[model samples]
Target: MMILRLALAAVISAYAAAQPASTSSSLVTYIFGDSLTEVGNNNYLQYSLARADFPYYGIDFSGGKTTGRFTNGRTIGDIISTKLGIPSPPPYLSLSQNDDAYLSGINYASGGAGILNETGIYFIQRLTFDDQINCFKKTKEVIRAKIGDRAASKHVNDAMYFIGLGSNDYVNNFLQPFMADGQQYTHDEFVELLSSTLHNQLTTIYKLGARKGLR
Candidate 1:
């Protein structure tokens, strides 16, 4: 875990440094991933074991208080948002359909979430990639209600999306000996499954008005 954190940190720093400066303001940014990018969505899950709402998780963040970020400091998504001069989008659970916060963006990442619904079953509860998309669908409805269809469509299309999924599907699912998926699939088969599922998910996002994003 420590090694992964260091490697990701280095990558974030490198990416931040490589980007040219821009005067354009940030658009709404949708974030997706596992614990690596989760802000506080898991905190809202009552029976979830993948929670990180206790001490030391957000020790290095503002006010030295836990914020359910799953790490002692800001996540990669947070770091990138900071570098981009944008407010890190809040957890999806922290907002409401009637809230004005949707205009900024939302983070639907969960601590044990993955591309597949069964990927983190051991964690008791975690949003899958499909679940996150459903949350976005609600967000779309809210935005559309607020600004009407045409403006909301433009808002969604213009927003930037960042996806950082897949890790949990391996570490918490297929790689676990007790899990059925490992026995059911050869590695090649598993890869194909993931690829196909990801393709469908991306297609859904496109149809939902996602014109640009990173995965």
Candidate 2:
């Protein structure tokens, strides 16, 4: 975990440094992923072991209370937002649909989530990548309602999307002894499946107005 944190920090720093000096502050940021980039989405889920909303998880954060992050402090999303000069987008489940916050961005990451719905079936319930995109579609509606179609269209198109996925697809699905994905598909076939799924997902988001993106 410590090594992962260090590597993530280095990546964030380098990514931030590469951004243009005069980047627009109006640039929105939408985040999606699993435990690695999750904020607090799983805390709202029922019957899921993929929770981080407990002691020892936020020992290094301000207030010293868990914020449902999968680490001791701020997530990569949070730090990257700071580096980019934008407020961290709040967790999707933590915000009301009617809230004006959607104009900025939202985080729809869940701790046990993956590209495939069955990746975290052992957790009973989780928001898969498909589910997250569906939620983002709803967010888009709200943004349109608040800002009107033209402006909302530009906002979404100009916004940056950050998705960190696939880890749980290995940790909870491909590597699980009881899971059938491995038995049903060879490693190469599994990679192809994931590739096709991701390509379709990216295409869906593009049709919905997501342009500038990162993953």
Candidate 3:
């Protein structure tokens, strides 16, 4: 009887220790980007021309509430989060009003945002990579406040960061300039510019402590 009680206590202690390990390994994914990844930040920007707060966008999502996700159903981030056994992140703007459920994940993506500082043609608000980084920094602070330093560090290190932005640069910046001048940059030159800008943005994130990142 004594031996059985001792073994039971050992098993209970092992289970308790394993709980944190399991959570640490549970893979937290943070998605950052433009309209493609903008789950709903545009909705909060009242004067911004990049608002998607309407139907048909979330027709396939739960309850069919247009959460400002640009895709007809789910963006790549949504699909990836579903695969990772977690819910898709909420927009950074929405974080203020929503409950703690969304504090764990954050989306800093905004419509018309680009890698270059001046890449968008929209006369309204546009988010450059620099602006996105600022939002990300703010979100990190909130995460730290909510989850503490250790869990926040684990989340940043283990989370998969997805960055998808560059399409707008081509469509809104390069194409328009080329059409106006009747002259176009060589494909290599365009690629070089995009690559250089992307590299700088990525380096900023790395310096900010993003360990697992994807672009």
Worst 10 residues of 3 by lDDT: 1-10
Cα displacement (angstroms), candidate 2, residue 13, comes to 4.4
lDDT of model number 1? 0.86
* Weakest lDDT window of 10 consecutive positions for candidate 2: 1-10
lDDT, candidate 2, 10-106, per-residue tens: 7756767787867847768899888877888888887878899889998897789998899999888888888877888888988887888898889
Query: What is the clash tally of candidate 3?
Result: 0
lDDT tens per residue, model 3, 1-215 = 23533453355334435545456345565676777778888787778887777767888878788888887788766765654556778777776732574346677888888777766646377567788788777766767787897876666766667676777776777777544311456767877878887888888888776886544
lDDT, candidate 3, at 174: 72
Candidate order, TM-score descending: 2, 1, 3
User: What is the per-residue lDDT of model 1 for residues 1-215, given as tens digits with 9 covering 90 to 100?
Assistant: 34655565566556556656663255578887889999999999999999998888888998789998988999888987886667899999998678888988899999888888899998998888999999999899999999999999999998878788787888999999999999999999999999999999999998999986755
What lDDT does candidate 2 reach at residue 170?
A: 82
Candidate-wise lDDT, in order: 0.86, 0.85, 0.69
The candidate 1 region of ten consecutive residues with least summed lDDT is 18-27
